[model samples]
Target: MKKLLVITVFLVAASAFLFGATYRIGLSLSTLNNPFFVTLRDGALQAAAGLGVEVIVADGRDNPAKQLGDIEDFVQQKLDLIVINPTDSDAIVTAVEEANKAGIPVITVDRGASGGMVIAHIASDNVAGGMMAGEYVAMLLGGKGNVVELEGIVGTSAARDRGEGFGAAISKYPDIKIVAKQVANFNRAEGLVVMENILQANPNIDAVFAHNDEMALGAIEAIKAAGLLDKIKVVGFDAIDDAVAAVNAGEMAATVAQQPFLMGQLAVVKAFEYLTIGTIYIPVDLQLVTSK
Candidate 1:
């Protein structure tokens, strides 16, 4: 009887030791406070939880240094995987390199890390989204007009790609010139203030292209406040609910929509595959999804 009891106890202990260990995945985000990114977090968490993988989240809150610190923490914890939404691309190189050295797969979600290679990049085609915004605005203005560009966080891929795409598209229409452009840091408040000033100088501005919905909404508010609502057609990227509502209401022209939830889902799914299958993707630009 004693021997049988001991065998049962050993079996239980071994099972606990094997199955109770959680596989931790590091999640580093640009801003936990932002609603769009909040959806990303929720989706990521849900996916990870469904797979019984532990997720360690690090909030950068729009700071590069904080993101680096969070990455370091994940490395120290020896996490199975690391997911990053870099605050700025250039600032995250060292930390991403560290994760690679530690044999942990690094997945870049939405905003990419600057000057570093990662296991996978999961995001909408920001360049295409930008070009879409530009084309939409040009068509809205009947292919020729003076427009102002409300840019996102400078130097990030989204900002650079979107701006470049928009610029390239607008160049096709020689008469459609960008009247003024400056970084609004992807913040609505900054967008409003910047557009308010631009309104003062370029009252005859025919359109406005904001790199993201937050900035576009702000620009719309500023345009209305300055009594130029009907005069300027506004186009923005990232179809946040507010932006879509504005589009439906005819308050703003249109927005290039990015699937934030899908970005999160893909990142989680890819991270799981890399950990389990040891797969390496062929070099191809994997654009997740972006739309109207």
Candidate 2:
């Protein structure tokens, strides 16, 4: 009887090994309202399906508190791994630390946590992309023009790093004075309202550089409303489909392109690799996209 039991146990173990374990991964996105993040989510879902792994996605709706709740829920579910696209770098640190304490590995995509144990980070060089946009704006205006700057969400890495890079690049051009600098919160509606106010204050603005395409598009509407579209050049980051179309239509000067879909796909692949073999880090590239 004992010999027969041992044989049955060995067969069960072998069968389990032959069929590969399915890892459960949690994907928490900052917001799905934005087209860029929606594409990212789709890419991740596609990769997970190919690998036969289960991915539970949570949308934070651009709320930091809600994002923290999502991470907590993922922890309570005992997921194999957690991937986060933080809304605010500082606000996400606490949630990441909680995941760390729970012994769940964490990976950050796009924005990073200010304090936490992250196995890997996947994103583009926002600073370089911002610098490119600033340089293009300067060239468009011949290095001497009144410019307006539209910033993204506050306390986010993308917003801070991109703003830093743009500031650094524009500092070299002494004559290119920034007449108005305001935060649009990366929302198109807010961008339009803020830009309309800025236009009223700075009537001689020659160019506008927005941290993201949504804001750039908003600024364009404001400029057009003011009947100054032909006079002012607009540059934006994140060459999303609509932004690229705007460039082609000659309504936008240029935009910096980042492969958000690839970032999402790689995040899933790297998470699987980390669970199986080891750790890995990837930095995606960026390029300038202009009307052709």
Candidate 3:
């Protein structure tokens, strides 16, 4: 009787050890300064709570080297899964490879890594979103106008894909000319400065398309300061709250909305799924938000 009792207790302990184990996931975001990324982080936290998993979030702060260091820390900690929103597509490959060498699967959210064995990628179709913005801008200008383009960070996949799509769409209309193109690094302050310079250099600007809402908002400020807000239409991507408000107030023409919260939620959920059974790539939806 004593032996049987001991065996029963041991079995219960073993079962608990095997079944009650909690998973730890690491999420490295490019930057939390942007409202869009903040929403993404919140969504990831919410999903982690529901799943009863531990999530260690690291803010890259828009620095590639810092982000790489964060990934190395996660690898050393032996986390089950690592999710990255890369600051630079090409620069993040080394970090992703390091995680892979540690036998820790890596997943990417929003932007992609140029070369890495990412288990799965979760993001919206940025190229399609950019094309949508371009088509809308062309329609607003009756297929003929002088346009300015405010680009995002040069090495980011979001910037490259969006620019490709926008250029492809604009190429269809021969009357529409891109007079000035400048890099704002997806920053509002830089957007204002770049737009101000473009405005000064080119007086016949009819429309502007910015890779992100932050930059678009900046351009709007410059245009407003120059007292040309009514004359020039502005379009932006990421459909952040401020950009949406601008659209509703007739201060901006349109914006392509990507679900950052949903992207974050799925990144966590998918990481958990891959750790358990298996998972596949996920592409979130995008919408063109305009006053109409």
What would the per-residue lDDT of candidate 3 be over residues 1-292, giving only the tens digit for each residue? 2353234334433443467746899999999888889999998888777667889999999999999999999999999999999999999999999998999999899999999799888888999988998999999999999999999998999999999899999999999999998999999999999999998988789999999999999999999999999999999999899999999999999999999888888787777666654454233445899999
TM-score of 3: 0.89
Residue 114, candidate 3: C-alpha displacement in angstroms: 0.4
Off by over 4 Å in 1: 1-22, 280-292
In model 3, where do residues sit more than 4 Å from their true spots? 1-18, 278-292
Query: Model 2 TM-score?
Result: 0.89
Give every collision pair in model 2.
none
Q: lDDT at 103 for candidate 2?
A: 96
Model 1 lDDT tens row, 216-287: 999999999988888889998878889999999999999888778767766775676566545632333346
Taken over the whole model, the C-alpha lDDT of each candidate is 0.82, 0.87, 0.89
**Candidate 3 residue pairs that clash:** none
Candidate 1 vs candidate 3, lDDT winner: 3
Flag the better candidate by TM-score, 1 or 2.
2
Model 2 gets an lDDT of: 0.87
